[model samples]
Target: MPGERLTQQERQRIATGLAGGLSYAEIARRLDRPTSTISREIGRNGGPRGYRPQQAHQATVQRARRETPASARAAGAPLGAAGEEIVELAVRTGLPRMTARVHVDLLLSEDGRRTAAELTRRLRVSPASVSVAVNYLVQYGYARRERDPRRRRDVYVVDDDALYHSVMLSTRHTLESARAAMAAAEASGADSPVGRRLAKSGAFLERVSLEMMESADRWRALLA
Candidate 1:
């Protein structure tokens, strides 16, 4: 069931269900499929508002035709040992293989700027697959989109500052959550273990936030 492709009729039903204001779970239940399957189907085709059953089916067909066998592609253009090692390390660090591959490819690019089409060609993956990988990178701060001056297409950029920005963003959220947790724990009972734990956690998070800022500044100076 995991790899089963959605039929055109199923996609039609999904479109109809969306038009009727049905939730993804409800649609999935009606289709006797997983909610994630329904969600992914809609997401990849077009989000709820833009989904068109016939167009989606056609797109899927085109994508299937365009996708080359991974093994064959690998044999044709194998990555260097260093690149493969980086991809493996990224996978070990919790990234999905495709996402990690895309990230590492961007990181290894000399200019740190690559078009989606270039990424698709270099990675030997379908355009749709590359789009997903690029979206993941953008969402996680591992990459960014910039308009190419010479072309209408956007360029995906991976640079040193991306990691710094990601860290700072995470640090802000952690500090905010820790403060909220401390407040909640105090409301329950400041003398309790929960309160003490929250207090310590918040203090640690505060220190981490400060250290992160200092490190970012030092890195900026070095870069400058």
Candidate 2:
């Protein structure tokens, strides 16, 4: 309902339309779909000389399969834990899965640095996706942005100090939030199984966070 699907018949019509010197808008109007939709479909499937209905249909099917629900995909080949986490985080943050994937790739790079345009070119994705990915990384403390005087756009870096700083900040915030949650649970006499589990997690988080802060301080001093 969002966009009229281009079927084999439509593909043939597209070929015929081209021979008749019909514009994309004219073809779209006849096909009852948006001009942009038709443009993208044709552009991706083969564009002008290479367009083939069966090939386009197969490509569409494959793309759909890749994006289908995990359950609907092959059994026992479930998305691994990291993949699942990325999907969940993308959903919660309203970011696309591809953005998370690109950011993660940049973060895991040996140099931990890349310019926005460089990332777009490397990933072969739209500039919008690159922008969203970089923003998400900055938001989560996994990456930091720095502008080069010579460059028009910002460069994202995954420096050790920046990463440590982000982790420490996030860990501290999590500890504080968990403490508050623990207090609320106790005040409500929620010491049942769920409450007890949550309280234990809070204590663990507080202790771990303090240790991490100490480690970060030591590392910073050593760097200095």
Candidate 3:
């Protein structure tokens, strides 16, 4: 409906289309939204070259928060549509739905950290659910757990390094898989045709993974 707000995904499409030199009408047509809505969104956020999807989405969230009443904030504000879109995007990247929600909430938090109790309060889930999701995040290096002695609780922390940590973890897993493939090939008779194919594929993966790690190290400072 025209009264509904634009989703984070719609904003992403607008950014992509704008970057690709698409006209407002074209972008609107693709989104099945009004051309005026597209025009107003870009105008308010940043025109053409200055537009960015993530920033635009965050701005929308900020606007909603600002509009919410202070009295209403005592119980915690809704995460908002933009925030939910962020959770959905995280889930699309292979995180389970609840884990993605917990992680994204931490990412969006003003302090980049939250206790299990705080998560349960805002997420409207049981403490046990928050504990399981947070454990998954901490175990996979997607987040860090810190003791908040002053608060007498553990806080789950997310930071810029969260993504970098996840990438490195995934690369490590790929390297292990490559080594396992080579081992399997040897056990299947190293002289066989299938064994040769497996060895070749494994060697390629191992080489690429090593090079990627080296390059990642060399350019790691860029993330800072």
Candidate 4:
């Protein structure tokens, strides 16, 4: 199992562990979490030179709050208070708290992209969490993984093309599926309101799909 969240006792243990000159792996073994997790938790909040449990916890809360939704971001609330408020809003809005945070963080980024290391530093989260967020955003079409030509690692990027390409592809798939369903319904002679509605929907889907496809192709050609 993943480790339980660090409590005050655990925080004290971490400080003691460090003072005792135990390696991160040793500390993690005692804490029942991955070494990388411990390393990131410490690295983000403060290093061995100056790690304070209360301060680390507060810093994590602040990082979480900074990535909350736009409305919350605009409120200029205190970190701890804002994080709690955002969680309440997340429950009401059906937003997966961490997922929303990741998306909002990406949206707020000036360059629309950040490396995993950069995110780890910013969010005070484990690298695993950062990886999960990046993957979620990429899979949901809200972000894209772009290979850095000069480097081995890929960065998650949000861009107009990411949204446009996702929408266009989805539209094309919907059009094709609609066409197939329409043909089958027509052949079955089940010309009820449902069938008629299906046909009409297919027509609309096809028309919009074609327009989007043509526009996308033109844009691609221009860029090429």
Alpha-carbon RMSD of each model: 13.0, 19.2, 15.4, 19.0
**Tens-digit per-residue lDDT, 1-224, candidate 2:** 22224444456556545434457998788666788887898799888667776677667656754777775333212334565466545433323355555655565567978888877776566888678777756865767888888966788987767657666766666566456546644654565764576567557767887888888887886534
Q: Write the per-residue lDDT of candidate 4 for residues 1-224, one digit (tens) a residue.
A: 25323443355556555644568998889767799877987887679868886777556555655767887454323224545465446333333445545655665678988888877676666798778767756754668898888878888888766756655655565556456546644754556765566567557767877888878777864433
Give per-model TM-scores.
Answer: 0.59, 0.48, 0.61, 0.44
lDDT of 3 by residue, 44-101 (tens): 8988878987787778766765776766443323577777788656644445556777
Model 1 segments more than 4 A misplaced: 1-78
lDDT of 4: 0.63
Clashes of each: 0, 0, 0, 0
Ranking by TM-score: 3, 1, 2, 4
Per-model C-alpha lDDT, please? 0.72, 0.63, 0.74, 0.63
Please estimate how well model 2 matches the true structure, expressed as its whole-model Cα lDDT: 0.63
Off by over 4 Å in 4: 1-100, 124-129, 147-152, 187-193, 215-224
Best-to-worst ranking by lDDT: 3, 1, 2, 4
Model 2: runs farther than 4 Å from truth? 1-100, 104-112, 190-198, 220-224
Task: Identify the candidate with maximal lDDT.
Answer: 3
